[model samples]
Target: MSDHAPESGPRRRLRLRTLLLALPLAGLLLSLLLVLPLRWLAPVTSAFMIAVRLDDEAGRWPEYRWVPYEAISAQLALAVLAGEDQRFAEHHGFDTVEIERALSAADQGSKLRGASTISQQVAKNLFLWSGRSYVRKALEAWFTLLIEACWSKRRILEMHLNLAQYGPRTFGAEAAAQRFFGKPAWDLDAGEAARLAAVLPNPRLYRVEAPNATVRTRERHIRTQMRNLGGTGFLDRLSE
Candidate 1:
């Protein structure tokens, strides 16, 4: 035997332990550094800026304007909750029920639907790229946990509203409100909020200014959902 040492024994165990410890420590540090700042400072840009720029020439100059959670109307907030994640306030970060539904659909060979909640959407839109890769999804979950740990539910919703895409090159509730209704987000009435929220599934295909039949049906469903969810009281309950 030539003096070659097999890579095993106590030394290997030591290295393995070090790596395991290092990973958690690094994750903790990353969470603190990134998530803490978001409590005060709004993100100037997001991963969407990267994804969009690759597609359209005009996407290079994306539209995004952040507004405080208070500035956006209650109706808009309720509409989004009703439209996107009805259990947003109830769950920590993930919705197991929705996940189960998605898994069941996959098992049945039925059309699959995204089960991402508002928090996950915020995390992805703010930090990660849009993709179907397992690595991307794992990172999205990590970011989502960081966000849930660092920010309030209200803040999460507010950020989602601001960062979420509304139309081609249009972002934020304020911008969407302006582009679609010619008014600020704060002034969006219930009907307008529902209409805007309805287009969230495919903003590019839906029109807020003149909602077609499909959008109208979705809008009606959202309104009914809002009522079924007991209105904005659900948000208050979530905070408690």
Candidate 2:
């Protein structure tokens, strides 16, 4: 009996080691799969679009559109960078400073805000489901690292521009532009672009035509940020 117990303990320890080793290996394999040119697989963006539709039908809500990267107005990109993640181009995956700031703010009884960089957003959109949980956040971090390791900044930005929710049922800049003004995204003027970017923080509540006073206020703030960033020039940098 003593001999059998010792043998089983070694076996159990070995099993635990193997399982621990396999976990990251599996994750690596999955990450590789995500980055590979698997055109047949349903893209993360498309899946989210479907989810949005289902939510709307079920009386839950999601705002989204499918705008191409090229079709989107430059100001839209700039405004988002200015408002959401100024260090987007520079950061690899995470923004520790912003994370600390957000944590401190939350601790002070302020609104709990996200410190997700553009790369993080792209990863979340492409791979993970939307929710605020420790597990979800951990997965988001893992996927963000994978995406940054696998995809270029240009590709990440492209995916984000196309899939980000702009309004109720408006998923991308092109879709939002068409839905709101009957204009294509590329033709949107500076003010129009700024207004569209303003609603991104909470598109469901912010309408283009009859935006609440708060929306109007946010638009003005975004425009100011855009101007400070040199407007169109900052947007042009996204391409380079």
Clashes of each: 0, 5
In order, what lDDT does every prediction score? 0.87, 0.74
Q: Residue by residue across 1-240, what tens digits does model 2's lDDT show?
A: 465445587888999999999999998897788765522232545556667767775755444455456677776777778777777777888998999999999999999888889878777766677778999899888878877776666667767777777777777777777888898878888788778877777766887777888888888888888888887677555433
- Among these predictions, the greatest TM-score belongs to 1
Q: State the local distance difference test value for candidate 1.
A: 0.87
Candidate 1 C-alpha lDDT tens digits along 138-223: 98999898888888888898888998888888889989988888888899998999998999888879978778999999999999
Looking at model 2, report the run of 10 residues with the lowest lDDT sum. 36-45
- Evaluated at residue 138, the lDDT of candidate 2 is 90
**In model 1, which runs have C-alpha deviations exceeding 4 angstroms?**
1-20
TM-score on alpha carbons, each prediction: 0.87, 0.82
